[model samples]
Target: MRRSSSFVLGAVALACAGPDRDAAPASPTSSDATGTSGGSTTVSGSAGTGSATTEAGDTNGATIGDTTGDDGASSSGGAELGVPMFVAQGMVGRTTVSCDDGLTWIGERSWDVEGDAHLCGSTTPVDCSGSGSTCTQRWFDGSCSEEACDCGHSPGFSKGVEHGAGRFVATWGWGWPGAVATSTNGFDWQTTLDGDTFGGLRYGGGRFVVASRTPQTSLDGITWTASQEADFHGDDGVTIWSVRRFGFADVDGGRFVAYASGDTSVDTLISSDGGGSWWRPRSMPSDCLGEGPGAYGDIIAGNGVIVMVDGDGHACRSDDGGSSWTAHTITDSRIASSGVWTGDEFWFWGFGSRYSSADGITWTTTPIDAPDDIGPVARSPEGTLVAVNNVWLGYEQQAFLRSTDGVTWASLPDGDFTPGHPIFFIAFGHAEPSAMCPGT
Candidate 1:
């Protein structure tokens, strides 16, 4: 494996290889390991130790690559909270996704889009997939669904949530400045429009790590304040496409893991203290981050072992998150779309089918009832794993699918849930999707 520790224009002097693994970048001299601040080369201090014994967003051994084979999620309160499953529609009085530590999560999205934009609106305050089958009255902008104008997408609603006080926070990243929104319970929300595409999100250690298509961050979960901000639209290092809540692994301290498109190099990034800092990204051992606008990432339990059939073909495992990965590649032309954490395994869906892995690795693929593009994957605090597929064209495709286990797939009916805005997926949740408690 390549390693980097230097100060060249403040960019973390990475010790990695490109498509040519043989061309590993030289490791910086000892003094350089103690990186300096400022510029892209900056990665040091108590805050930037960049230790291999490091962790991003959560999901691995605090001692990088130290997989002892025991996933400590049972104690992380995951089991105690009943294997978080997505609640298609959070029962009004109760919070949607709750925590093992007694905290409740609420994502009450309040967006205002024009009529022409009706692929679907925030159907409910929380779960947004509506009867995309029926052509909406008109578009949000031009009555021609094609020109739908909007203020932002939706996350769903909120109710009486019980998060571990301070442990409960929210982060949203719309497409523009002051466009992001957050809420402790799906009821109250804070907004930001820093011009970042808020893909996936998670709340931890009193802050939020909002992942964008680029490398942007925020200090508070409700704001776009960052210790360091990068041009989210810039062409540079790692480019994270999505963010998710990896609360499955149950790491105690503040940390999070964001599955994103690494710069020209790595395919994923892990952040321990929200998005304040990042580790040198690593590429997927098998597939490249994909050519489609598709996002790639799979959650791991306490042991840092992931059962991912996400985006890439075949099942894979990353004992060290993406820092060091090992995957089983397949020639099948398919995408391992979205997934969830089952009490005993991980499940994902895509290309009209479903797949699962017991230890976050190895898999059993099969056909399912959902259409393509199942991006929003959530395993509620109640253990209902829900995955949604976005069919911008209507009944020609099914919008969302549900899974009781990471393997089985089903449909989420929009019976009573108020299809508030129309955010089919504001998905958060992963085994350490945010960060795993210390040891696994």
Candidate 2:
């Protein structure tokens, strides 16, 4: 959500106040992924009496400050509910304060630092002080070691994929036209495409496919050509269905299955010829509409099964390629925002919880120490699950988390990149020969 000008005014008032400040500090609230506007979050100091109502914004609602009583020791009226910590777009928000058994916000001291929006009281600085042609560090005990990395280049709301043999392709939504970057290792990167904005990027059937109004395909992830035969338009040809989200999976033999969700229409297109051509195989089940929006969900194929899950945890699976689908429940109550298949099991994180399933039919929830509103998770080149979480101070900042088994997670030192815009997607990429450089 756009920051209201009133936030500036509130900041000025708190800055000029006397040493014994009595007024509560104002914190900026965030909107949901759909860009839906909601109510304003109001927090008061002195008694720390504040109330946050559910809004149409991000699934996690708002991020507020710690409410403290007059004595600053005991709790009063501020512990009723919990607020979400901000992440990037489409992901759930986390809570900043430590909670009790009931999950109520109960931190005595305020985690919000005045004037610095990116600085968090709980954030630990990372040490990048090692030497190597390219040294890789690990996230241990909530801090990063002194190794360097080359994966810091900003792609402007980008998504990437590790094609194979250390080759990577990352495409962005806004910035230069056809904005794309390629890397050979997981670290270094170089721009390859500069044409039009792309919606999604995936690799299958011996090529890289980019989803847009008219999808494009490339064998090298550099030069691109439009799939003239691939059709996304409805039967009318005038009602062009917008491709919001899509997923690719390799079925039996070398054949691949691509499931695409439409932005405005309920019709979903399926491709069997490696995204060369698309046809409406079937419509989403009526019961799936309860999962929030029909156009928004994560479609993943792995372990010989293709799974499509909506925002509300409603899931459907296809075993005989994309020809047929069977709807199933996740058993958990929390709504899932994003999910990824880790070659073996399907893992989903949202609303302050993480769940994993090997068959996509039954799920097992795991306990996570991180915030509930964490961003999307992808398998890094090193075979670890990496995810990002945002800390909304005075400014927006990010936190990195890594899990080797997808069950237990650890925090990596914060990356140097502070997003100036909302990041819509992030995937693993390989480093290129020309893009290889010393780690910072």
Candidate 3:
């Protein structure tokens, strides 16, 4: 276990030497523990903490090593029937995958993919073999059907967030008539809102906000009310065009920050009165601007700071909320797409690489050993970092990988949900029955 110390900027240092207004305090020093055996890392914070230990094998019952004990049971309790992790809304129609542990997954609970009841009623594990099979399918991206399932109604983007204890909501779609699903335990889900696609969904300022054609807010993630179009302008004092990406983060103190990425530059929107009204503090640095046409990413906040990473390896950091910014260059320029603040550090991942930074200013890169392209990465309630693989091309079946320290990874075997088309969205639920968190 290689331990790394984090360098955090104090709130006083980040405060502008002006009037002393009430500001959110800086977060405590976060500690992460990695287990050498299962490749699971336990992060410590308010969200919860997890620890690593030796496990038998992949959850899908595939033989990797001596995972099962003499009694034909896993010593790590991974093989036991546990809480199910619900997967919802993928490239095809309304489909979802569920897993108790990360090893075994069930469901490809699909609906109206080929204009038929194919794989719609069946709750059995996914079958990758056969003609017109659900396993070797891909969405309509000008790809061969045999190689991938090129179909319509595929999800463009999907996002989810925990609102309260045992309460969660997710929104996804490509165009109008998008869908929203809600769950109390991360297992059984129910669709609440349909129609009207939303680019992002977040919980902050005592309400749930969704960035759709127009921003919408909800008190319980069920009923919603629409707001005016968000104001997105560049430093040139002109509204940037072709907004491609949207993101939001809670900056504490009943305040929140929202981000929108356009073809020319990225814009920031700050809300002191929750989601009621938003204003722009200052424009981002020139280096934080988008590179080519239709290029954009998102911004993530943690430990009293906000960070934005684009597809061009350029990242901007803001200590005093999203009012001001500073740019930082990443070592690997492979277009960092998604990132998460693990309380201790920021972990970013793209196609073939993973990068981590203690201070969000300086970064170190590591090559990921994924069988195919890496899609979305999230920290499971168990404290394990779970990442999706093989989402781009349909040549191979989609899979998942788990990592503890971001250095070592383990591939789950082919089970019910293992051998299927890549899912566009993956998120960790607040309901953690396994209690994978350490010292819980």
Root-mean-square deviation of every model? 15.3, 19.8, 16.0
- What tens-digit string does per-residue lDDT give for candidate 1 at 1-440? 11111111122112111111222122112111222223212211111122222223333324211111112122234332223322222211122332232132333223323211222442322222232332222222323232222222221121111122122333332322223444433333344432334444444343444554343444444445543442221124334333322322223333345443333332345555445555533434323233212233344443345433433344434555445444453214345344455556555555554555555433455555443345446655445555445312122233444555444455544431223332233333322222212112
- Per-residue lDDT tens digits of candidate 2, residues 229-294? 444443234343334456766554322333332322223556555455655534334333222221
User: 62-123, model 3: which lDDT tens digit per residue?
Assistant: 11121111111222344333343534344433344445444545544334334322222333
Mind sharing the TM-score for model 3? 0.64
Q: Flag regions of model 1 displaced more than 4 Å.
A: 1-110, 113-175, 192-199, 204-207, 212-225, 229-255, 259-267, 281-302, 306-316, 330-333, 367-375, 391-403, 406-414, 418-440
| Best candidate, lDDT | 3
Off by over 4 Å in 2: 1-162, 174-178, 185-191, 233-238, 254-264, 282-284, 289-297, 331-337, 381-383, 390-395, 414-421, 429-440
TM for every model, in the order presented, reads 0.52, 0.56, 0.64
Q: Order the candidates by lDDT, highest first — what do you get?
A: 3, 2, 1
Local error of candidate 3 at residue 394 (angstroms): 5.3
lDDT of each: 0.35, 0.41, 0.46
